[model samples]
Target: GIQVEQSPPDLILQEGANSTLRCNFSDSVNNLQWFHQNPWGQLINLFYIPSGTKQNGRLSATTVATERYSLLYISSSQTTDSGVYFCAVTPMDSNYQLIWGAGTKLIIKP
Candidate 1:
């Protein structure tokens, strides 16, 4: 079995601030992803990094598989960024099953 943990279970920031979210896992993973649950409850895929780093606009993510952890970075935060950010992974021992983190709740002030 594998376990996923997200740090800073809750976060509050001004609209233009920058923040970093962290995800740690207990075992090796075959697939790792980041998602943002919008206010409307729609899940938006942010990254799918089993290893290495990736960036998209004001967002970036890095997964160090060897160390069993991942990081998500957000720059110049916006009100639209408010929601729940989740980290999900499929362990090396499982197929078609994703273990989800409790999620980090983010609030961006206007």
Candidate 2:
């Protein structure tokens, strides 16, 4: 089992700006996912990338299994994007439990 950690603890950006959030795991992960928790506490899955890169609209993510880390990129940030970004993962074998990070709080100013 491994622990997850998200960097920049907090972030503030203007509308239309771009930013990158990072997540570091203590060990190798077999399963990894990224989520965006909106202001109302709604969880929106952005990616299920275990060891590759994928883009969706204004968001994209990359996971490096060997380096045991992941990065989430947000392009053209918006006011509605203000919320917490989280990274969840399950280590190899053992129980199918997911370990979540504290999350990176993002605030998009108008």
Give a tens-digit lDDT track for model 2, residues 1-110.
Answer: 58899998999999999999999999877889999999998999889999989999999999999999999999999999999999999888746788999999999999
Q: What is the lDDT of residue 107 in candidate 2?
A: 99
Give the candidate number with the greatest TM-score. Answer: 1
Residue-wise lDDT of candidate 1 within 3-58, one digit each (tens)?
A: 89999999999999999999999999999999999989999999999999999999
What's model 1's lDDT at 97? Answer: 97
TM-score of 1: 0.98
Candidate 2 residue pairs that clash: none
- Stretch of 10 with least lDDT, candidate 1: 90-99
True-structure lDDT of candidate 2:
0.93
Q: Candidate 2: which stretches are off by over 4 Å?
A: none
